[model samples]
Target: MSVDINNYNPTRVLVGVPYVNTVFHFIVGGGGTTLNLTDQISNDNSIGFGKGVAWIASDQAAILANIYTSTFSSWLSSQIWVYTQLPSTSLASTPTAIIPNSQQPIPSSISSELINIVSTPSGLVVLDVSGGILFI
Candidate 1:
């Protein structure tokens, strides 16, 4: 469940698989432009994303999905960030999503971002913290 984007191409976006811990950098246009897949950082083991995908909603709107927490101590939740304007470049962008934790038989104990994401013809799907899948 991944979007296969490579290198620093501005026309495409890459959302890595669960535990892959990667997302593309973006340079947003006034009218929402195609999201880009720029540099990916793998060496930084301290931080990582579980899973997610990206898509252009319109000329001025795009959906970027990922696992995020407000702080290291905050619970990592699966969510999407609606970018009215995308960041020029930054890994610490915001994320907002609907979590599937309540559906899990056993809740996740780890207090870090641990969701996986994929795209489908229907829309975006997420593998949530407690190991359940939810369609967005």
Candidate 2:
């Protein structure tokens, strides 16, 4: 996904590999910086199967990501984690997690998986595979 963060103008593109639970930030015409999720979320034993990613309209410096987690055991679970302060240059940083919302009236709790996300001046628009739209 590509976003226009005023601080990182021109274009900031985010790439993620679910299987490896990795993410990278590439500045157009510049170098790419990898985001290490392992060190940050290892304590929680969570794996990052990136479901969605988007910049926070309220705070461009921050990003929100939807992640999946499971122990590959008899039971499984999923969760959303948040990280911040991505470095501008070399050296890997923690990958940020995401939370989405929609304009349509929705319940206080959201159980559906995030399908995609869009950032607007006001907030984020999240689309779920269940055809539900949420605005945050």
Candidate 3:
């Protein structure tokens, strides 16, 4: 008996590839220079303002951590993210931090960072505070 290889189709498998908008299976978080305005990998010692975090990068319109000491956009000033997939879900925005404020460290894990991702538009406000997303 011969089988049609092209007929092989799996929703979970196909939709979960390294394509655009494909959700990262793991969580995203980590502590690596918060007050940094540049995404340069060399300048990683300045991880102070919102420092000490780790995560496995997951699929979300915006990563919203709970590290808000003030208005949630003060401290660090800015942040950088290395996206696992291209053409990210963020339609209008570019790669950005999971949390809203570039100021404080996320109080919770990246998963609970946002109040509601199911209803969120794009441009995830994530919190990089886990090791899984970093490893996988």
Candidate 4:
């Protein structure tokens, strides 16, 4: 079965869905944050999460992106550096999220520093790394 983000509440700290080959960027207090996706919570990609709508795609090439934070203002006050492609995993992926410098040639892969983590209070987040452009 495919995966989707069920409960991505930024205020309370829960976020995201099971997405594959996707790159998710984040913002906090008007700045960007980093999220270290953990394989610690659960391994199975089965069972549907009950609340979220179609925030992320359930297909293999879909991305589930969101802003996670405990602070209300911080959640609202951040600038996102979106990277649509999964540079680390996919070789042909192009980052539709952020535009690179015109002088610098666009690389076939996404840059590591471009992918920022979603900062939240504390909760179980998810990542699928399957494929596609990231969407919230």
* TM-score, per-candidate, Cα-based: 0.37, 0.52, 0.18, 0.18
Better of 2 and 3 by lDDT: 2
RMSD vs true structure, all candidates: 9.0, 6.7, 16.4, 17.4
Predicted structure with the largest lDDT when compared to the true one: 2
- Give lDDT tens digits, candidate 3, residues 8-106: 111111111111212222211244222211111112222222122122233222221223334445333323232333232221134444333447443
For residues 1-136, what per-residue lDDT tens digits would candidate 4 score against the true structure?
Answer: 1222323422111233423213232222223254333221211223121112122211112222223233322221112222223232221233244223454332444321222232223421222223222222
lDDT of each: 0.41, 0.43, 0.25, 0.25
Off by over 4 Å in 4: 5-64, 72-74, 77-95, 98-136
- Residue-level lDDT of model 2, residues 3-122, one tens digit each, is 333333434555544435544454554343442322121222344434444554222433324445454232132333334554443213443543322433335465455556666667
lDDT of 4 at 83: 29
Give the residue spans of candidate 1 off by over 4 A: 1-11, 15-22, 26-51, 56-76, 84-114
**How many clashes would you count in candidate 3?**
43
Global local distance difference test of model 2:
0.43
lDDT of 3 at 94: 41
Model 4: which ten-residue window has the lowest total lDDT? 50-59
How far residue 71's Cα lies from its native spot in candidate 4, in Å, is 3.9
Indicate the worst ten consecutive residues by lDDT in candidate 1. Answer: 56-65
lDDT of 1 by residue, 13-105 (tens): 444443455555544354555554444533223333424445533211222234334344544344344333444344324433233334432
Query: What TM-score should be assigned to candidate 1?
Result: 0.37
- Top-TM-score structure, candidate number: 2
Q: Could you tell me which 10 consecutive residues in candidate 2 have the lowest summed lDDT?
A: 35-44
